[model samples]
Target: MSSEKSKYIVSAEWVERQLGAPGFRVVDASWYLPAQNRNGAAEYSAGHVPGAVFFDQDVVTDRTSPLPHTVPSPEFFAAEVGKLGISESDTIVVYDGPGIFSAPRAWWLFRLMGAKNVYVMDGGLDGWKREGRPLQTDLPEPAPADFHANFNPYAVTSFEEMRGIVTTGSRQIADARSAGRFTAKEAEPRAGLRSGHMPGARNLPVGLLSTDGRFKDLASLKQAIEDAGIDLSRPVVTSCGSGVTAAIITLALHSLGHEDNTLYDGSWAEWGGRTDTPVVTGEA
Candidate 1:
């Protein structure tokens, strides 16, 4: 693995330089867990990177599903991104307050919609604030653009497909939840959900992939995956509490040049809630 930084992530200073440049878009994809007690939208309203548009995780989701923040249809996603004045060709940079957390979901969404030139802002908005970069409270007057979304279903895995993987072990399953939650030693943040991992799943907590709100170098990221007993040569399915942090694993795997990977959108929120799903209560 190499220490290439340009493929998957960009620094705060680099984002500042591209602020007013043409065909470049900055998106604030901040989202918080319920326990964090913080409102991502409210924080974005207070202040964000200049010319940055807010991408609400809750709003940019499939409302038809009972699960929280499910991925929306390609048509709906295109309309919402178009309203944000983002064209498919533009360079999109996504960031959250905490680096490599919720922002990758937006990055993943852009890729799933067949939009390229997307990168996650390393160190996130917290690094921007620490560097004393310009922050604006006033919203930009967005001019709607033609964002034709071409969705690729291969980037995501359905529940039925995931169930098949669990039974057959055809692909590697990576759980991005904390060690305690993954091992069923601690309770889940969501109520009424079982605390354990899928059968034959590998535990790769999000912490190992990043540090101090920034992702590690490529070699380190690869080593972390290898230490978790995952083979990059095999296919992978990443899952988290509700499919948000799952992208962190997907991002790391993609950064490592492993393209045969898909995210489990239903994640544990759907898996643990059902009584029919077989969940193991210890390490894989």
Candidate 2:
């Protein structure tokens, strides 16, 4: 069992204490499903934590990709972070509406872009508000900072990489979609998408890694992951509906001290949509 003290998660209390620290940046990385009918940027403009900047998921992605929120090039990422007043040296604390959901995607993005001092705020804004932390409606206008990016390609899985994994069996493919979706018992929320899991993949829903939007302790996290049949000793490639929630799995893997992992940015949106990719139904 792992100790909570060694976990990567930061409590709202610790974040409150670190408010206004030099070189510290808080980011509101809230994202919503199309069905939710909520605009993330609009919500951030209305009320957000003090000194927190908005990290627009859609805008910071690969604009040319047909898939949703695919990872952007290092040059593109550096430019976007520069506009947000974020630099490689800054300690970035990212949060979302729920606990650890969308924040991990942003944390993963920063890490991919060469930012080492990045973290996700546990329980996110929901926990912060439940604890009566202060919030501000006034939008901050921060001057752009110089951001240097060193792209790490190892952290991302290309379609070719996934194709190789399908046959080699060298890496564990973990799908973060619900069991119903993974088993093809339920239709995908997005229209025109196929319903099924990747062949030879293990289903580990992202919600299992969190409790009411907050991440569970390290011990519980490890147990949940291993129980899903994922071997932490081997490499892992995380995937989800559209590669968004997959980062939740990546974050959980990191918290458990598993370093060899990558995120399938196209995720099910690409794999399930295509006719050539092999799909499987039923539990792994």
Candidate 3:
């Protein structure tokens, strides 16, 4: 068994034990692209981790943004999460349907909001179900609590910051999009966006970071990053179609005990859509 550890991720057995434990809360951060045709709320309604609140990714974002799933204001996050009775003091464990995909976004959201004890449930809800863990369909009516969000501006990246990084070579860029999208061979799911990746960015496709729907162990994850030609010692900024899968990179890096990384919230949705920013079509 690999003894490697990630403070940002917890195993199903660990969460089972922590269930009903004081100061602990579980959140079903399930979400899917429109192409998937899966309703996150519907799945959560059918069955979910006991006491787990559903964190709707679509609604928990900046509604004003034209792109999808943009991070919402700290006040909005606090209020939204507070409705589920999650406070700053509570240890929040987040999970999604397919392991290691959407849950990382929720984990990153909590971290960006300055959450102290948020973790992504390793193997996610799918793995939990496969293991015969308990589930519940009834939603809990949580008494609202005050979630005082302390936003960490450094945890996220902006389009202007990405431009500076590309120009200065200050940070290594990683794209969580697939190889096709990264190579410009495949059309973007979102219309009007250009094909290709940000210049100097490495393709880390979020799916490659996992196995059997679960994230790989720390050693394998380190190898994956190294295989992408990314210098393990340098900092990384993760990007994706709309900043969703990018969190998978953030989760992987955090699992490796890496700290000098951030997620580009706008990602390619903003960068590729704009004609001003330089984009490269081809492999790194």
Candidate 4:
């Protein structure tokens, strides 16, 4: 296996070579939209990379929160990760069913919980499966590990910080929702939520940053961000329907070496559902 500094994104070929390396943990962080009606854990059980553990986003998150997939407390995260046999020192490669969707969320989650060697598999299981990579139907029985937790607040954004950004426009807000959703032309998939975006936010639609679930190269990522009118030199906060796909933007920013980006934990779920928070719609 490659060192941490050289391997933030492992291709299918590389992952195949390091299938059972020591200190390596593969996690299937697959999550889906409610409308899709897909069960990530069920799919994971049916087939997954050998020795891969299922990281259930809903079950592992802040259960007390009304919002979806809120980042849990560091203690909570550590406890859950420990059950999955992951530790701070492990080289974790997280992947979802799709290429780069929910996997980045898992990557971000580990990073926030102080895992220095976390990574997102570029093509994910889909890529692995497409390349005819080996998979196992029977789950591996891993001994539970003790994961030490350290919280990094800089990787997360609070509602208060989001509100401040809305007023000051100091930090550039990048919305990962589709252009229609960003413009309020289409109804939200969730009920009782406003259709639009946070005020002063730019619509970057995370899908545009990747092709077939894998992220675009650095040059394309730069173009995409610039096309969205985001000033990369300034601070950036990424948001999506909830907070899942926002991590795609976070991943892209990190790939570009923009380390100042933060992911809005509440995202549009908390913002749009609140009657008091400001909302604006229409093409940018």
Every candidate's lDDT: 0.92, 0.88, 0.89, 0.88
* Highest-scoring model, TM-score: 1
Query: Which residue pairs in candidate 4 have backbone atoms (N, alpha carbon, C) closer than 3 angstroms, thus clashing?
Result: none
Better of 1 and 2 by lDDT: 1
Residues 1-284 of candidate 3: C-alpha lDDT, one tens digit per residue: 26575667788999999999888999999999888888889999999999999999999999898878899999999999999999988999999998888998998999889888998887877789999999999998988989999999998898789999999989999899999999999999989999998889999898888876667878888888988888878999999998889999998888887899999999989999999999899888
lDDT of 4 by residue, 1-284 (tens): 12222236778787778789998999999999977787789989989999999999998888899999899988899998899999999999999988788999999899888899988887888888898999999988888999998898888889998899899997999999999999999999989999998878999988898789777777888888999999989899999989999998888888778899899999988999999999998986
Best-fitting candidate, scored by lDDT? 1
How accurate locally is residue 28 in candidate 2, as Cα lDDT from 0 to 100? 97
* Candidate 2 to truth, TM: 0.97
Any runs in candidate 1 off by more than 4 Å, and if so which?
none
Model 4 residue 277 CA deviation (Å) reads 0.9
Q: Model 2, residue 179: displacement in angstroms? A: 0.5
Candidate 2, residues 1-284: lDDT per residue as tens digits?
65583255788898889988989999999998887677778878877888899999998999999988899989998998899899999999999988777889999999988999898898888788888999988888878998999889999998989988987887999999999999999999888888998889999988898888778878888888999999999999999999889999998899888999999988999988888888888878
Q: Give model 4's TM-score versus the native structure.
A: 0.96
Cα lDDT over the full model 1: 0.92
- Residue 247 CA error for candidate 4 (Å)? 0.5
Candidate 3 weakest ten by summed lDDT: 1-10
Clashes of each: 0, 1, 0, 0
RMSD list, candidates in order: 0.9, 1.2, 1.4, 2.9
